[model samples]
Target: MNTASPTRKPSRIQKRNRKLILDAALEVFSTHGYRGATLDQIATCAGLSKPNILYYFTGKEEIHITLLNGLMDTWLAPMREIDPEGDPLEEILRYVHRKLEMSREFPRESRLFANEIIQGAPRIGPHLEAGLKPLVDETSTLFEGWMAAGKLAQMDARHLIFSIWATTQHYADFAAQVRVLMGEADVEGGARAHLDMMFRRLLRP
Candidate 1:
């Protein structure tokens, strides 16, 4: 929580310690959730003392918020990459594939986000309203424009986005169940192929 002074650059040790705390906190919070996680657990996971964690972050909530804020940028990157000028169907399919890739590669992060959202995003609610809402509104308008132009099939743009999130994130948020059902099969590959076909058909003009 803004531990380092603004005027002075953080030392190499400070940088290393901060990274250790964040990486360890990600594991703890992802496994236990914000309510369940503790600074002691983060300290143990980081192999650092409790005091060390406190030095970097004010407390558990601060650490959790920092992680969520960083994750928000990562989570929104694919949506931000949506090009308004690109082919409507191709752009949407590309976004779907990118989202699936994130779920596969960052399962812990995905689950961490899912947990925050499911818990009503008490801490992150303001951030969501500020950051996420605008992006969604903009994307909805983009999708609506495409539909109006007959470039994409007519549908509820917001619900379409929500469906994309739900479908893609299921692979990560429910990874344990998916693994059990998939049983060593190529989960990401299958999901990508299936989602591509599904969205293509849905959005085809």
Candidate 2:
């Protein structure tokens, strides 16, 4: 029995309302996390009634999933820009810089994504497997090629990628701790310089 709902294109108002709901949902979900957030909270944040929020999204899970799916592209775009034709060291350092920039500029999105991963990614696990894994695998292959050519230090490509992720995201994910530890100093610029230096030393041929 095929009982799925038919899909229809959204009208102009529908588009605007959907964006409003999603923007509100991001704020709520990012602050409260998936398990802690509620439809009423999202509605209140959006300045829409609970019913109106539900009209745009059937439930909290749908909104969270939509946000994750949409943000994944932006999150992974830096790695996707690592060109094989470019200098290996420069390409990697550029990617690291872009990631650090993202952590500084999009801390909320980073935290939201981190929260999902910390909770075992119950909603996004499938998406990670189907979408993220292939991109990572391709990047890993590129890393191996660079290593084989003696352009990069011989290290585990996967671990190198993981280190980059952890180091860059730590500033954003632990912003409060970082702020307190660093006081009122320029944390972003300092971290950016430190990461650049660290990766350069680590990746040097």
* Location of the lowest summed lDDT over 10 successive residues in candidate 2: 1-10
* Error at 153, model 2, angstroms: 0.7
Task: Score residue 199 of candidate 1 by CA lDDT.
Answer: 96
Candidate closest to the true structure, highest lDDT: 1
Question: What would you estimate as the lDDT of candidate 2?
Answer: 0.91
Using TM-score as the measure, the top candidate is 1
TM-scores vs. true structure, each candidate:
0.96, 0.95
Model 2 ranges off by over 4 Å: 1-7
lDDT of each: 0.92, 0.91
- Clashing pairs in model 1, backbone N/Cα/C closer than 3 A: none
The number of clashing residue pairs in each candidate reads 0, 0
Tens digits of lDDT, candidate 2, 11-51: 78878888888888888788779989889888888888998
Cα displacement (Å) at residue 80, model 1: 0.6
